[model samples]
Target: MFYFLPLLLLFMTASPNTAIIITPNEHTFRVHQRAQWKILLPRDYANPFDPDEIAVDARFVGPDGRELVVPAFWFIPGRIESEPTTRVATDEQLRQASFTVRFVPPVPGAWSMMVKVRDTERTQRSAPIFFEVKPAPPGSRGFVRRSPKTSHYFQFHSGEPFFMIGPNLCWANERGIAQYDEWFEKLTSNGGNFARIWMSRPNQLFETKKLGVNRYDQDGCAFYDALFETAERHGVHCMLTFNNYRDLVDRDMWGPAEWPNIPHNAINGGPCTRPTDFINSEIGQKLYRNRLRYIVARWSAYTSVACWEFWNEQTFTNVDIPPAWTRDMARYLKSIDPHQHLVSTSFGANSQHEVWAMPEIDLAQEHQYFGEGVRDASAPISAMARSLWEKFDKPSLIAEFGIAGEGSDIKFDPDGIGTNMHNGMWASMMSGSAGVGAMWWWDNYIDPKNLWYQFYGISQFAKQIDWINQRFEPVTLAPIMSDRSQPEIFADLIIRSAGGWGKSHGKPIAVLPNGQTSLGLPQYIYGTEQPRYRTQTILNVGIPQPTKMVVRVGKVSDAAVLRVVIDGEPTKDFAFSGLPGAPGQTKVERHPEGKWQAEFHQDCELEVPAGKHVIELRNEGNDWLAIEAVTFRSARSSQYADLETYAMKNEASGDVIAWLHDSESNWFNDRAKKMPRTISGARLNLSVQSGKTYRIDWWDTWKGRVIESREITATGGGELQLEIPPVHRDIALRATRIGS
Candidate 1:
């Protein structure tokens, strides 16, 4: 009987269990992108002799509603790498279990895998776990080929211009990943398509060990995974920044040291110099290379990645670097991930030429902070663009161009803002700038309520202009010179596209006839004057044949007479006084501002036969005139006409004030004392356009109190609303603000 009992036990243990269970009761594996799929069995078991006695079935599904099959396999402990085994009780019997099966998908995409086990007696299945397989990124499209030296142009998938309207995400604090998603989404919905994500050394992979900051762990990976996934879903591109400008200077600050406690020198201490010894050290180079390699390996497959910016504003501290080092760093990056896009550090506009000389850089990026008026703002930018284009002929981008409305004396001017941004775009386009990225979309990070609305307006306008594929062209208009007489004044005549007439395909020729046009005063200038001021007039000397011209104006009545002189002889004097002229006849239209506008068209009998004609205008008996500038395409010359000279009087003291300052502190006191006090309440009177930000500052001198120090966004003309806080006695108030 004992021999028989032993034989029965051996038979029971040897035979496949009527029921099976798997350890790690549940497991998750990413789908599509080739991840190994494994299943654990309750205990090591052999297949039963009767195939019908054992049943195994598995199925996998993806987030996109696609399903896949999982192959069945026997549980072999030693044959396959044995994972930790576990014991579990099923009803009355206890069994040992081991993991089984291995699966790997060749492609990438999202998926879920489920394994079901059943015997003749019962059926049970492991809980299904979910995972994601990212989509393959678009590597290189054949449409535009990129050379080793030339960088590839990026075309946004949304069918819009490659205009990046966004802000730099430089929050150095440990912001929870959940918060990042919310902020990132808000940016995208608000017209931002790109974000600069900083990769801190202390928080990153290798440097974490030294800094005592945890290295790239599951938590960080999960955060990044969610961030990248969310970005892709929202159509936002991330410019992965490896380090801050400060990191480039003092590498040891974030070096392998007490990391979390490692004070940020840029913040804790003053700006410090880059550790050249560390950078040149073998360990330093190795650390740098390893860090970069890890990042590339982890994110190279992400579609939301725009480009890898080597560092943020590397010139912030003026770190000296040998040419060899620059070449070496560029070469090192290229060697690791040749397919990844790259950008050099952004620098001041003046430093563009020197930065572009770096062989590893794909794009020349620059930052500028010009005031809101077009003419004053465009000069330096134009010069910078032209210089870069003439020297390297590479694509350039205005990486940053912004101005704080606070602390500025300038009032909000829509036309001025539009003109400033437009001029920058035109300059870059004409000077071969592939695109322009607006400085920011939102404002006042500390106070979300103070967000800038003008960013959206300007971005919308930019989309329209860029949609036309208008490239800036250099035109040599004889009488026009590029100069700005007043900070507020600006003017430029550019040919967007021309030469549609010749027998051969003629290139679009753009003529940039700037302030130097033969107008009486410079074509563009801003100044304050009495009720009557001299209006500068410009004349077009040559009217090419077969071309048509139209003139548009705002805020002026009594149209200027257009005198056309061909080859130094007076040919015709056409009067433009309305909209849509009559078959080449000059026409005029009235604007909402009660200003009569005039248009002069060539190609009509009213126009002189085109050869070489001088087109000129003079201000004749018009008052209160304001020209919004002009646009001429094709061969005709357009002139500024009908200058009305009128002075802005304070009315109280008959004083003309070019600028007005307003604020909360002295709201009542300042308003009571200023001229024209009785005419209106306490308010600053200044000519301002809709959709601009005006900054004002004031202090309560009487109480030694600071009262109103904030920005006021102007929606339209008239008195702007101010939130004057209660002024406390015995405290002086000093406040300052700016508008966009």
Candidate 2:
């Protein structure tokens, strides 16, 4: 006698009739916990990863009599191999073929499951297995979800607010899982709860090598399993990023290489001949879908995997990601993933409204890297966060952020005083972002410098408020500066140009050696037609005195030179000498022969009198140099305090959370002095409920605790005035309404 269920039957294929053995890891499991079963099918089949050849699925009936179907994926058990320097472990594969079904039990009840194997000839069903699920323990908040009450915040299944507060743990270095273990422990201990992880480059779990076509790297898979397990243990939610633009491009900012090693290339007997082909071709889509199926099957059960980001800076890819591609891929991914995790993708500091507006992209994301011309890093973060939130009316994420795009600022600030890292975190949170700005350079700077305390401080402060139900809106603050004679310097990036490989006069030009071929350049320089190697603009010097102009040049090739011509009179040539590293050096490594030896020099300065004059920057040497950003110093300095304020108010209850930042107390300004000028007497004025009493707690952003407290009542004027305490760099304050 055989028992058959209609919904449970998936696919049947041809194969030799053989016995299927199923062994349960445990007969019972707790709700929200992973329930797995080991399965062995004794059948000889070529390409077990191909569903056309072999398909395996697990079907289960929950306590509510609802049927749930989950796919089964190949898994090979492995041991960890530790790297001596960082102790980051990689997988040492063991040769054994097996399949497993992993699922997180949703509810507490008795459930029954059956495994079905399908092939061309016949479909075989294993004996049904019964299991019990116990209720989850107290304080166990389920997976994160978009709060039903708010558009810009996240909440757990239990309706508790989940404010993400951590940096990007993109990939591990030598320390691998062990590194994550320490990192997660430090993060969670500091009250941090989120991390953005990339599934590309270094230790990616996908099939990238030629021999691994249609088959995932078993070692990589095992590494991820351990990584996720470690993350879950630390209670850190991971934004699992799938692909990066670097995976498709042959050359990037790092320099020339053999990117043809990927399995998708035509040379590897795959479907795509060009990078764009993968997004346009049917076969490529099919291949991607297969990979997605395997990914969801293997890792969807882990609650730690919060969001599924499709790509990291997708616009940087050689082929632009069409909205249809994102729409179709996201739709396909959602269809198979029973968990229905949040889906997102990122761009290079620009919003792709067409794609982000789609229902598939749950969150709008961008990566922002500021140049040296930027005074305060957090200013852009706050501006971008507010722009994204208001434009799309959705939660936003600054997925990758840093002082410089190329590398960590550790090379600049060797003392490791993380001013940019700290300010960016508080700024994003207060600026209506879904979470703190996820900073980049984790391995080289953040982790090594032990800056987990910054994340901890944000986390501690976030725990005091209800982000989901508060319905917080940004509040405009009126500041009363105590110091009226503080000299304020007006700084701006005067000349911004991108030099690499771009079309010039309808012809392709490679100005810088080892530059990315697909890199885009501005069509017109400063609104005037100009060649790629040169830019001309009229400088209407407004100040009455001489202004200092600093030309920051980068991406220099051998024998490259830059000349500034003012009023048709050319200045002395600024020559490059053996690519001396400074300003933008992320790492110290010798360039391979025949490739470009790039240099970073920011000391080229020129003084211009206050008058209207035409200025031109021309590459006069045999090679070329990129004008990254030209900064100008104003001769006239205004008197004002450099303090900045951002606040959010709960409309329903007059509660407010605010932060005050000393704009001048930044890494660039204070790194050498190692001191931030303390500001004494200041006042904050904001509107509140008239005649309402409120209690304010001023928090120390660095110490992660309350430094001062005060009680006040709003008068009939409806404006509450606060006497700001002595602030060094920045401070957080929470004003909660007292009584009804």
Candidate 3:
């Protein structure tokens, strides 16, 4: 009979007038649980999404006298298949349309709600409806936010830390919602708690509606309703990116030609005349603001919506997003979102530093893709994340990362080992990043290959660390081998230069018959590392072998000279020329002004002997040469052990976590090697409080469980030494102070 108590209360507070119908999902809601009121409006408007045409909102007054003005979103109810394997709603028929006001009750008490409806001319409000909220269930956490105690890490309203540990489930395939169901199940079951999703273009939300129209698609809205519901069920927090810059362009790495179909194109009646105008023009901003309103109204109530990202790789758009637009949108979003979720935007690797430094940007995100000549993924991943945090003084996230941008690692790794994917997750989390790096290629690689286990170990390790209150600082450790000799660390280093080739020389030397300016090549300038056409790459000698270096060159003027300097030695100009002088010159052509013949697409190689070296590449020619990439390959196997280690320690307490990786076990070398090079005897020295006894747990990364445990007390020098176990590829160690 206790079950009927809520139904009885629902009937008591609701008015006798049948014209205003209100149905609650529960008789009594719990704190942190969604309190939904499905109301059947007497009238229907043609465009419910546009608040200017018609608006519906609910005024909720909590027990603590806090008034929440929440907007009611339109909903077309439908039923999903019971226990279905896939999540497609294609066959289902829609029921009568209604408005839904969803809110998560913060405290346990009596709550009152009133629905207000407004049309073109008049406004009407329903009688106040009453309800009750109970205490939240055990272990239930509220919304996520950047911890006030620490700006770099996230915490729940319940004061529990939130460390994201999942990949990018950007969009669904033909199976629709069912695909997310399967993916989320596998991910969450393996300890994943976060996913990055895109709500742009043909695959997702906005494309289902007419381009440029203020109206939103009902079907798209339904998809998200199910998506959030599924995410909540699986305990996965979602980062929904509103725009994918590729949707605003005619072509991207994905491949394309049809600009007419692009929603942002002027031909589609969008406000922007070109892709670049989307971020700068006044009209574009108006439309974008409308879209933001609809987004907030529809999905802001969900506890699973962890972050609201404005764009995915906005730097890859036709023109980089200006700081003004970033500031305006972020401020606007903060104003509308009642929950005040975290906000951020992604950018191409090392691009758009000026915009990220703004105070409005909550998190600085970097997208990394390793192409040819880059074999080790962990070093660059750690370096880039650390660089963003250092430069911006905010939390950083590697939003999108993979071995290759053009394609998935499946082509190269048919066995589906996912070595880079594994290494990247460990590296980013230990690099003082907000959480694990969100990897790309989810559809073709992560899902199809069934690589969910890669997330397990890190999630297990994260469970033991309190990221918010601990204030962990990142540090590196060097291990000593049992043979009393330093271990060999190999790396296939990649050095990237600044700027592209064939840019205009600003002053045109001549005018063509078609009335176009004939611009000459820009003059080369080389002095220090900051000067144009000159860059430096620094690395310590890890292997006792000569490093193979390759330089990619494009379009060199006749006077263009390639110079290389090593370890303060005299500058040695490579044997290369533009006009029939370079040995590997494949093509030489005159510019539009016919100034001189210049070489195009040439490669220069050099071998630097083993030792500590500072290599610098400079162009001391009359005209510039577009140098794309410089690669240094160093790999050799010896009868010694090399472990790459990164750790984070809490200074107040002697609590710390460390990840150790095999030096030679990169994507390139691991595939070609026959047997696993196992290191058995090694010693690692870590910094801890003097004389503190700490319990150490050694974990098997693949299995995600502690294999062994021991306790050790630090010496007078504030150092604790651990005898390392056998490491096949990688391992993790968690040390906790016994008394602390």
Candidate 4:
């Protein structure tokens, strides 16, 4: 972290002379809120070669007497040296020379700060000014923070899960803000806490944003100030991208048509003759850095700003020296900004370029859009998100993903329920994304269509669990095939336990949020602190008849208590028990420290009757356990043995539940299969302990209400297999284990 705090340079460098005074946003602020002040330096105090001497400090002494000192960087006027045309001022006259000192007090207190500026002669410190910092209003979490305990998620300073659920409001200019406000209001009101805004539109929030370059757009700053204020009012977090790739181009990609308005074109007197050179050009970088400095100085202290995204799809515009440019700009932003917000850059849909892997970025993000022929189902999308998650191993998001836009062959859907918007959110979460995949075309499609409820559904389900504290890999079971005339209602079987082994490992997989499963040997898990954990999975399997059966539970390296049952009766009544593997068990030691090693094997089995049965595998000791494959058998049962359903587990409460849906049931795949929507009797086979009772509950997606509820006993068989009501869109059911 190469910093630019000038006062810290007392042991070093030479000098200059300056007189500076302070202007504060407030003589006070809320805790973790900005306590800002501007330092007006004499215009002649400019020194391009050594700008650090003019650094200003925003100091806050807390009630506990703990002091925090932050450095203020200049919000210099940018210079593109371009031809002055319609909207911008010429370069030479626009050399911005000003300073502002800002800092956030993380604690409530009576704090005093003095403005200080260094010069050739001496250090000038103003008389200390006092201010009071109250605590922020309820629900404000200061700023989004990376989870300290896990690598894949984010939590608020308030420690609540921050699951983002909204689309791109990139064109949110003040020109028609009522729409943007409505969008923001609807989004926040419907559980959306995120938005991706672009600051690139010409004269939107950045006048010389693309064309003239260096000149400061005071109007732009006011626009952004209002933007953040609006976000704060709606309780929404915004990810503002400084520049999007399309802005670099002077015309459309496939043709030679020129955009007369783009000022950065070589014809406009800028250095770059093509979009590629803009990133590599010294003049462009300088102007960009100036803009970055201004952005940080102004918006860095706002709680509503989630991150400072550098470029939107930097790789697409053929930008020269991408890695070097991304690296340099990321560093520059980090150096001048006192508040270290998250940073990221994106690429075209479904693509992960070299830049997405850059360590300078806090979040690895990409764009993905699926049209005709491209599979648009949540499972496939989950796989897409998972693939990135597996490779990046950092906080990740689908910054821009959708099936719209004029250039895209895919047409837009006003009703997003059966569209990507609905499935995409669920898929993003299953694939282990920090927030929902941002759908493109917010104002045009999402708002007017009343599709905000799509987000409400996703957020409601997401709020049920803590993604940051718990790591979950997708739990995949064999597809439970249904007769053509039957309702192919599969079960939702999410692992409701702590920690995980990545999803998918050849047979049945436990996929990591990144859409990947770990190989044998070196392994990484979210529940590293807990030495051991147990899982009592109540699987829903279909059994054609009340025939004899053999049940197999994959073995873990640790000790376990695996059992099988049939309709509340111990399988022993059916005369069945499981045995450990021949080798017993084996675990791969983690590299380096090698303190903890997770073990695995598929050597456990039992015998039970073939009916809708539940399998319960408890633990005798420490918590960690992995059952690679659970196979129920009989002679020729391999053809009959199957697992179908998706699970959602809530750890805050000891409930591990799952939903029932055909792997191919989503509308996207249905379009491909040309499958008709038909209703049928779906069977739910859950694994329960012998002698236990349960309240089997089923929710109907169409009616959005509980359609069925009944109590049934697990008469000691360790399995409760039963038939469910007619399956419409899908079945969301829960078998709350009552008593044993």
Candidate 5:
């Protein structure tokens, strides 16, 4: 009862009994629209779910006879998989499946494709099938890239700078699809053009799935179909990220990324013994290439799919040495994709090894976190962006970042994790990253906190910037914090003198009737010079040091000894010898407990490790000693910029971008608390021509709107000043040279 259509039967499995179906034997599609060629066959003929075992390609011949080969992957419709264990596709339901390639014609006119299917044992070909294509809709320029313009920015194939600014959104359940739709629609309504769609891990994949190992499921593909359709309608582009590290996250026997949950694991009756094994094994390579074939054939046709990122933080996996694997797979992707959409890989670590700097990557990607350092998250963000943007000298992206802690302990604040998500985007933009930093924990943090507005604000700022035509370079600026006498002074509010807080300082302390009062921080007591204990000192004295040194202490804890860390390394039970006496005195003292305690009357002599040293005096639980005085036998060190601020000028146009950043907690959105005027007054100091008139526009980080404007003439050739407005969050500015 079956009819044989051999003339155009370009692809079929090795088995002669199976049937192959090609829909729309003839076709017509507009440019940038998909033309799907589907080949269906019985399960006996090929492994529908095994991309490694089944490979197909359709070589489309343009009007001028230029053939562009596009691959095809398996797809079969099924319902969404949810909680409570269940199976959607029965063996009979998977008997017949399809290999599909949805390609959008790059150019309009008459076109034809020669379909080819490669089975494990044989290859089958189909005769030419002709089609016609039309021009794309108005206002559509196509996929993003950096070709045709060698600038440090991403531009569409049509050469418009694609300054992307959006969150990393993975697939949401049906109930949440509406939310996603609204998010995408709103983003477009406010000028956003880019986002990242994560494929998630094995058990959590919403875009790709394996139905009982040998058969594929179409539900994931269907979700993307509607997702991409909606994206095209809203003009939102997507960065389709492949397997995240969670795929092989085998921390335990059963968890979010358990081995049994991953169908591709060797224990699950598939290829590769471990998570890292898949990256370098031959069988793993085949499976990966097969997935690429499936993805490239299915999604490459649409301009909406911006780039195919192979891995999300590859280093997060056991594959610590993954650069080679990255290079291999990246090269494979480059060899297959027809549209040549960008190809990139992100590292969980702040930076990539030199191998990542290879040409295979289109974007130098990095992820950053805050709270560990004394500075705010923005400082590291701005540094990572500007650093990689210049070092790679290619387009760089802060693919993932926020105020979360590192590794498994990462915390996501449903309340928005302070203004970190806000500041990260603005800092990244002005720091010269190819796009505003894409926020992670999209569903939990971005959506719930309504942080998407930050992108809209970033998009607004981006629209005003002609990053495509006018390239810029970040300029070195003066330190945000000039000088520091003591480590504690850098704190927002320091208790230097115990005379209680001065009246000018917010919330004055209570004064006693006897004309004497105590500040909450005893160290702040005036005149008496109450000691501030538990301090750290990191220095680069820049000179060689002797084997012994002495420290003088004005205050002490009779029983408890402090820890003195040296040369960036910490040492415990560092008893002050209490010898060499005070800076000007000489004496030795020992307490009843036999532990040497630093005395005000003597210089506490301690052995100084040779070479450069960074000293730290930590209180061992008790109020041990104060950093009232330190007599380092070596020279004193200089101060580092509390913030890593920089500026860049657009040569073609006289406009400039100044990025100033601080990683102070007061700058963060903590427990929904707002920063006070004390957190204000941050500034951007950049090199400018003296006497030149410049129009400066202060940017609001969260709102992405201008807060104020001023015209200032540079007073010197070395640097010029622009004050940060009184915003609780980070700030940026765009300066245009009017005249000299």
Candidate 6:
């Protein structure tokens, strides 16, 4: 009876373990360009299972269709696992199993892996599970790198400046993956090269206390990994923000406790002070380090990583913590991996002065939201950058700069947004600093019509600049003016080459106007009297007679390399100096009537000579200069005004206004389509007084429709006049509201 009892017990235990078996989980692996793969398992399987105890081995295949085996080893679970695998008791009714495998796919392609589990006692094996791998798609293609020894900009490979033309994308998880995909596609197609992905603190990625067990529990991490994979595939780089303002230690880490607080206002609610030895004391840092280590070690092998942003707008909050804490955290990251990738904080400020000064920082990042009327804030901001460059002498990048636009108004005058960005970029580039132009609300929040078009324009401009860097050598210039007076006179020039001699043999020059005058270039003398103010006219010199000269005016940006062609021929390279020199037979001369005119050879060609031309005379090396209006002439005569002429007529005023046409009156006729209706019939009459500015607002009741609004300043009369468009139906008028 005793012997039979022992055998019965053994049979019972073995029976449960033998009958309950799990087949390998089938997985489809898809990675984009420059991405890697990693698989996590349950904690029970931390140690390798005996071959006889398992049904199948986990194997991964490469792009070459070859199988690669992962080394099996036990790892400390840290905060991810609560107990050691050996501590877990096994019974016949159930047995726990866990393990993990990691692999980095070098290129884009379909990949497969097989997972099988074998039972030794039963001599049975589970069916093989298949998984696929994908590479980074067309638009996405870079990764972030971090270093401790130098600032973030130095981390980027020299000559390969990381230019991110992207938007601030928030509420990603709430938006879901499909919307994310569409947004990514739109941004990438429109010339956006990167996305700033946010990860709130107390999120699932940091919940696990142990590695294997906790990693398995990280659904958020899994979701983001998928998104990262998608971004990589799309050729879009991601600046993954570690935490948002609400999730920080100094703020409410959980819930919307401060919902009513104004958006950029600083509110300290959470435990702002962290332990001195956080990594060694708190369980969270260990988990954080582990997760970060895993992330860095895995993602570092891919080229898609352009930079690793530490936090988003952390400087805005008044967190009571020593600066060394951040410094240490940065040091810890660099110790694990030293790659040529930039590491920075998504902080809003003149980063060149504050953040760049931190030993832990690489690039200077800032966010600008200057109001509408003060459209040219870029000037001062850029001037500050120049001062910072001279002071710190480090590489800088404008991490963020944008404007709040309702719709098409913001799009066209995106100059309101673009000018600031363009000027900032110009300042950075001309000052030898890396520039990152940011678009706010391109996706995720405000859905604007022609949003993609705006992005495309910015992207094209950036690409042109990039092309310039590839083609010509970059030579920086000193600011022409040190004072705020006559900002229009400051000019930044990039000359292709120096020293020229003839009409056809003169060097070509590219000029970017910063202030009123054309830098210090040469001006013609009409009658040897000093000119009162600098003008946008080219002064002729060394001419013996009144002669016709072809002048060209074109848009030149920091992001593009432009080639100037006179007529059908290219111009010779020339240096960009504040002073102009006489070339070849080109001479400044007075007419028989004692009037001076500049002349070019009859065979000289001109590009963009369609606009009206005027002649100006100035004295050589003297303050005397005079402007004379000449007859408007063009090679192709036409009475039609250019598009700019028409647009200038409808420019917005201080008060809110809308452009409505009578083409479609449904917007005016449909009541159900109007809610908080700000637009209606072709003619919109609203009571607006003079000297007041109103905000234009609208809502689209349709499922995926968009509503737009523009503001018009009141001319001081009791009635507000507006040119309405017939595109929309119902309209509601609201007085301008200010002061929250």
- Ranking according to TM-score, highest score first: 3, 2, 5, 4, 6, 1
Error of model 1, residue 535, in angstroms: 34
Model 5 scores a TM of 0.70
lDDT of 1 by residue, 624-688 (tens): 22333334334422232101011112222212211111111111232233321111122223333
TM-score of each: 0.42, 0.78, 0.81, 0.65, 0.70, 0.44
Backbone clash tally (model 2): 10
Quote the positional error of residue 685 for candidate 4 in Å.
5.1
Candidate 6, which segments miss by more than 4 Å at Cα?
Answer: 1-162, 201-217, 249-287, 297-303, 338-340, 349-360, 384-395, 403-433, 444-446, 464-740
- Residue 577 lDDT, candidate 3, scale 0-100: 57
CA RMSD (A), model 2: 9.2
| lDDT digits (tens) for residues 115-219 of candidate 5 | 787778777787787777889877768777875565578887666778887877765654544655887876776667788887764223432223333333355
Question: Which ranges in model 1 have alpha carbons more than 4 Å from their true place?
Answer: 1-152, 156-163, 172-183, 200-223, 248-274, 349-355, 370-376, 404-431, 440-740
| Candidate 5 least-lDDT 10 residues | 495-504
What are the lDDT scores of the predictions, listed in order?
A: 0.39, 0.71, 0.70, 0.55, 0.59, 0.37
Per-residue accuracy of model 4 over 259-291 as CA lDDT, tens digit each:
234455667665567666566777667767766
Between candidates 2 and 4, name the one with more favorable TM-score.
2
Query: What's the residue-level lDDT of 258 in candidate 6?
Result: 24
Best-to-worst ranking by lDDT: 2, 3, 5, 4, 1, 6
Off by over 4 Å in 2: 1-20, 81-96, 122-128, 483-640
Q: What is candidate 4's CA lDDT for residue 412?
A: 38
Evaluated against the true structure, the overall lDDT of model 1 is 0.39
Residue 344 CA displacement from its true place in model 1, Å? 2.4
Q: Using alpha carbons, what is the TM-score of model 4?
A: 0.65
Best by TM-score: 3
